[model samples]
Target: MILTVHHVTTYEYDAPMRGAVQSLRLFPSRFDGQRTIRWDVAVEGGLRGGNFRDGAGDKVEGWSLRGPVSEVTISAIGQVETTDTAGVLRGHREIVSPFAYLRETSATWIDHALRDLAETAVTGVKEPLDRAHRLSRAVSDAIAYRPGTTHAHTTAAEALAQGEGVCQDHAQALIACARAVGMPARYVSGYLFAREDGAPHEAAHAWAEIWVENIGWIGFDPANECCPDARYIRIGSGLDAHEAAPIKGIAQGDGSERLDVTVALEAVQQ
Candidate 1:
């Protein structure tokens, strides 16, 4: 299946920013079961300073906001061809070491709640693959999918405690829980195809992947509670969403900044 993606992020500052630098991770890389045919990124009200790959191997672009800048816009467009591999991404070169994924982050720290959640989610789950599937479903069901209830800084325990959050929250909870159970889990930021109209949505999607003994790494969308298929386009992977964030930056002249993000993931018929 062929997928087309459009992601636009605009920052409106209450106060004009001068001499600001920003980092962007909006580009997707080619991997097994997924191939990027064409991809480009454009900026408005800013100049592209440079581009490089991050520690996690994500393509990143740097931009410098000109003085007296009140708003900055970033747009990324790409097309990718994806194939279903029975939920297995075979022969894809590992971007991060398995040991690194097991490392805990602030948001995904192992705790009692996480361990218990993992135990319950993987209950009666014998095979590692089966456990992953169950864990995904359990997280989706356990946490009510509600927007505006959580933010990017919300941790996995907090979301689990609240019983409500968006895709990011669900992914974090799942990752923390999986790690608590001694499974190496990582975060995945990407796009998901909507079910109602088969149209793309404005917000980006997130999921979790766990490294198993024999199967290598497997992805699970706790928000969607399903394995990645043709509908998913993976942009990057890391210990948590913060590491794989599509865009992150700091401004020199700081006061407050308003962010407007719009993402569209469409499935094109051949």
Candidate 2:
């Protein structure tokens, strides 16, 4: 399948900021599952800086904007060809060991409830792949998809306690549970084409990837209760959503900031 994406993020500050710097992980991942045809990222009134591939094999780019700047806009446009690999990440070069993902973040911190959930989900399940599938299912069963029920700062434990959240919550909760079972897991941010199942999901999506002893990192979307397929476009990953964020930036001022984002993804006929 061929997919086209248009994503724009704008930040508005009530009071002008002195300046801003941003790190972007908006480029799609390179793997057997997907190939980027053409991609471009631009920031209005900003200069592109150092670019490099991180240890996780993610392409990172830096940008800077001079102020008194009240608003900043970042745009990413691209097309990618994807094939279904049954969620298995393959042919991706990375130096980071899977064990490194075992480190938990605040967003994916495990608690007694998460531990119990993990134990119950994987009990009697021996295969690491099966254990991962079970954990994904458990998270899907535990959290009802409700968009506004949680916020950016909502943690996995809190989302599980509330039993309602979006894809981010589901991913974090699954990560927490997977780690509880001694499996290496990380959060994945990406884009998803329209679902034939009519499930509610944004074009931008988040999921979890668990490392099996022999299978490597495999993606599991608890929010959709399935493995990623051709419909999904892989992006950068991290221990949690905050770390996997497509865009991270800081403005050198005390201005109150508000953000707005819009994303459109569609399948293009080959």
Candidate 3:
């Protein structure tokens, strides 16, 4: 399947000040099941800077905008060909050790409730792969998918206790649970080509991937209760959402900032 993606982000400042800088991870991933056909990223009134692929296999580019600028717009347009690998992240080159993801983040720190949840979900399961699947399902069952219930800083333990959140919360919670049970897991961020019954979010999507001994990192979206397939486009990943965000930047100014993002994805014509 071929998927086309368009993502646009705009930042409006209350007052124009001095400068701004951004790190972009807006390119698609190059892997066996996913191929980048064509891609482009542009920033209005911004200067492009250093760009490179990180050890985690994500493309990073820097951008700088100068002066009393009140607004900056970033746009990404691309096409990618993808094949279903049952959510297995095969043929992706990343030298980072899977164990590196075991360390917890502030957003994924495990508490007593999280530890108990992880333990209860994987009890009596010996196989690591099965344990992961069961845990993903357990998270989906525990957290209801409701928008606006949780905020960006909401931790996994807090989300679990609240029992409702968006995809980010689900992904973070799953990562926390997987790590608690001794399975290396990371967060994945990318576009999902939505169908009538698919990808149910208004913006970009996120999921969790756990390391299966021989399989490497296998994607799991507990919010959707399935593995990623051809409809999913691989972009970049990190220990959690903040690290994997498509765009991260700081605007040096006395002005407050307002961010608006719009994303559109669809299947290309055969």
User: Residue 137 error for model 1, in Å?
Assistant: 2.1
Candidate 3 or 1, higher lDDT: 3
lDDT of 3 by residue, 134-159 (tens): 88999999999998999988989899
Q: Model 2: which residue pairs collide?
A: none
lDDT of each: 0.79, 0.94, 0.90
lDDT of 1 by residue, 38-146 (tens): 9888878678888877655678789887677788888999898888765566656545677678788998876687788789888777788777777788788889878
Arrange candidates, best lDDT first: 2, 3, 1
Candidate 1 weakest ten by summed lDDT: 194-203
Off-target runs (Cα >4 Å) in candidate 1 are 123-126, 196-203
Would you list the clashing residue pairs of candidate 1? Answer: 202-263
Q: Residues 1-270, candidate 2, lDDT per residue (tens digit)?
A: 999999999999999999999999999999999999999999999999999999999999999999999999999999999999999999999999999999988999999999999999999999999999999999999999898999999999999999999999999999999999999999999998865396646999999999998989999999888999999999899999999999999999998999999999888954
Q: What TM-score would each prediction reach against the true structure?
A: 0.91, 0.98, 0.97
